[model samples]
Target: MSVMLLIEQVLNGLQYGVMLFLMAAGLTLVFGVMGLINLAHGSLYMVGAFACAGVAAATGSFWLGLAASLAAAAAAGALVEVAVIRRLYDRDHLDQVLATFALILVFSEGTRWLFGSFPLYLSVPEVLSGAVTLPGGIEYSLYRLAIIVAGFAVAAGLFWLIGRTRLGVRIRAGESDREMIAALGVDIRKLYTVVFALGAALAGLAGALVGTIQSVQVGMGEPVLILAFVVIVIGGIGSIKGALVGALLVGMTDTLGKVLLPVAFGTVMDASDATAIGSALASMLIYILMAGVLIYRPQGLFGEAH
Candidate 1:
């Protein structure tokens, strides 16, 4: 491959990794603080994408769509927490899983009913649609680069929110001992709602950003959701830093593996067979990485041991 092509792929991988971090960050936070396993988190992602697509299509304003995505996802998350998820907090993980699974069905069907089964396309905003030349004379898409910047900005903001603020302290305390925090007169219920909504907002932001690149449709979040789970697992559940590192690792490994494996195999096998085999192995690379990490560090790289 040309050096320029390799550079572009690397950029692509970085962009993808950052996006994964957005989703995984929320998943990790919710799990760490609330001790609730939510399967419908992806549905919030879908909600964001749908809200963005609908608003952008109606008003022809990407900014409006973006705002709508944040608002809609956060609102939905808060609503779910108050009406359903709040009940699951004291329940078993199995119950939480089942309830959230039911939520997935509701969300998917509800979205399909509203938007139809056809996928919606979100155009990149005019200002960000073009490509820019880098120092090495390689051209990269501006919108994708914007995503990388935006993702990192959000990550930084989240870290600060969790590490340096009053809410962060409360969150940490809740994570360590929910009963103690509640006894200390903390509004544990309200805190859980806020955290859930915050996590949903992050997922929604990721969905909105990704919608510009891919088709926005019902069930679109499931694949990314699974990947996000893998990210948190490999990074150590509940650790934002771990999520970031794991996401980047998975994204780069998946992207580069896909590109490089084919070339490596082409030397020894027929071109078609090499492409097929390379694609297959590339798909499995992250899972292999996940297993290796689990074997070496069961609590994950950043997780607290039980």
Candidate 2:
């Protein structure tokens, strides 16, 4: 492999992994703190994208659109938790699954009704619209570089929130002993709502950022949602650290596989056939990683779930 090409691909993988970490971190938080199986998490992500797109289109300000995404997603999440989600807290996993799955249909149809079936476009800000050369003589999109920086900043903030703050203490206490925390004058219901909303906001931010790179359309969240689940599973569910590590691993594996698999196959077979086969196999690399993880530690790398 050419060294420059390898470097570029590694950077691509890093960017992809950071995006996945955003989605997975939120998901893991909800699972860790609330014990809720929310299949509609993807719906919140789609909500963020639509909110950003609509607001940006109206005001022609990317920053305003970003703010709107966070607000809209947090509001939607809180409302849902207060309504449908509250009822399902005491229900079995199957019932929760059935209810959340229904929500996915509701969100998709509602979004289509409001925004139309066509995809909406979100342009990157002029300040971040161009490419910047790195110290290694590599040029990368400024927006993408911003995303990486933002992801790391969020990760650091999340770590501090979970490990240092009073709210973090309460969250950990709730996760470990919900009943005990409630008995000690803590409002468990309110805490759950806050945690859920926080997670929703993170997912929303991810959607808003990704919208600049891809179409902001209905059902867009579903694919990324699936990958996020895979990330948490391999890294260990309910663990933010696990989510970050798992995301990077999945990102690297998938990225490198797509590039290397075809080349290796081409050494032995026709180039076109090699490319097609390699592409197909590369798509499954993350799942293969998941399978490998599950075989050895079903609870996940950082997961306490048994």
Candidate 3:
């Protein structure tokens, strides 16, 4: 409707997209480097949330909770990699999917057992508890803006890590040919573990960040996990740049569709019908985009032509 409203929605979409990027970034890495389909990645996200909530509640410090979330998720990830996932690495896709799917059940049940079915709420820190005025005189939440900044920072960091560092080189080598990297004296197993842990840590960070805004509860990671899958698929399975672009595209498309479509349809139809139609289409918008992308570029927007 108004310019202010439009800007607000755009910001909301950006924030949402960045969060998806966090999830998708790790997912793409795992798929690209390891060729493993981890269905339990979302469980790592849940693990981070519960870890954050528990620590925050116990210590009365959100920062401590955040740290705990990362540690817990990373440790859990490393453990899963060594114990179960290692076995599945050379297995078929169905086996990997089944094993990780089992992990999702295990993590969810264990979380429910430890935390109970009740949801946990995190308090926004005092410094980030207020709103700030943006350039257009629009008031926005400091916490949300903080999320946007943090997400971008991570993206930059990832770019540097993958593009500049020795680890990045090793990772690229591994992706191109695992056997060759091992032959060249690289500890391929160790590299895979580190990558999985790193990806899991990213997912954890996302969970901790989102936990404050949403409920920290059992099975909360599934929907986000699904969206993350859509992100990776649309972005191209192994491309970080594609993940970023696809996430933003999906985020903005979904958000704008929900808002603008309803308004546009309302002018030509009844309010109830317009709202229903808009909401339905909005939910499907990202998937529709994915289908379109796949039809045109089977590998994805950033995926290498195969």
Candidate 4:
């Protein structure tokens, strides 16, 4: 590959990484603070994409659709937490998993009922539709670059929220000891709801942003959900910093592996065989990276050893 091509692939990796960060960050927060294993989190992601697509289609404003996505996802998240998740806090992981898995079905069916089964397309906003030239004269998608910037911005905001704000203090405390925080007159239940909603909104934002590049449709979040889980595992559960780092690592490994591995194999083997082998290995790269991380640090990169 030429230098420019390599540079572009790196940028693509970064963009993909940030998107995973968006999903993983929220997931870690919910697990970290609430001790609840929510398998249905991806449903909120779907909610956001559908909301953005439906609203933007009706109003012809991508911005409005984006806002709606946040609002709708957050609302749906809060509702789910109040109606179902709160009950799962004291239950075992198996119970939480079962309940949330049921929620996945509910969300999938509800969304299908409302929107039908057709895939919806979200157009790139006019201002973000074209390619932009980088300093090295590399052309890249402006919207994807925007997604990277937005993801980093959200990461910074989350850091601030968890480290600097009063709510942050409570979240940290809750993570360490929920019973103590509740004894200290903190309404742990309310905090859990807020955290859940925040996580949902982040997932929704990710779905909406990614929807423009891919088709917005039912069951889309399930595949991404699996990757998000891998990200959190590699980063160390409950660590935002870990999530971002892990996301970038996985993204780079997956993207570059796909691009570079075939070339490396091509030098030694027939082109067709190299392509097939490279593609197969590339698909396994992220999971391999996760397993490596676990071997090095079973608790995850940033997860505290208990």
Please provide TM-scores, in order, for all candidate models, with all chains considered together: 0.98, 0.98, 0.99, 0.99
- Supply the global lDDT for candidate 1: 0.94
Candidate 3: the clashing residue pairs are none
* Candidates 2 and 4 compared by TM-score, better number: 4
- lDDT (10s digit) by residue, model 1, range 1-306: 899999899999999999999899889989998888989999999999999999999999999999999999999999999999988888999999999999999999999999999999999999999999889899989999999999889989989998999999999899999999999999999999999999999999899999989989999999999999999999998898999999999999999999999999999999999999999999999999999999999998889889
Compute the lDDT of residue 37 as modeled in candidate 4.
Answer: 81
Q: Relative to the true structure, how large is the alpha-carbon lDDT of every model?
A: 0.94, 0.91, 0.93, 0.94
Q: What is the C-alpha RMSD of each candidate to the true structure, in Å?
A: 0.9, 1.0, 0.7, 0.7
Q: Write the per-residue lDDT of candidate 4 for residues 195-259, one digit (tens) a residue.
A: 99999999999999999789899999999999999999999989999999999998999999999
Give the runs in model 3 whose Cα sits over 4 Å from its true position: none
Residue range 235-258, candidate 3, lDDT tens digits: 998889999999999889989999
Least accurate stretch of 10 residues (summed lDDT) in model 4?
Answer: 32-41
Residue 200 error, candidate 3, Å: 0.4
Q: Tell me which of candidates 2 and 4 scores higher on lDDT.
A: 4
For model 1, how big is the CA root-mean-square deviation? Answer: 0.9
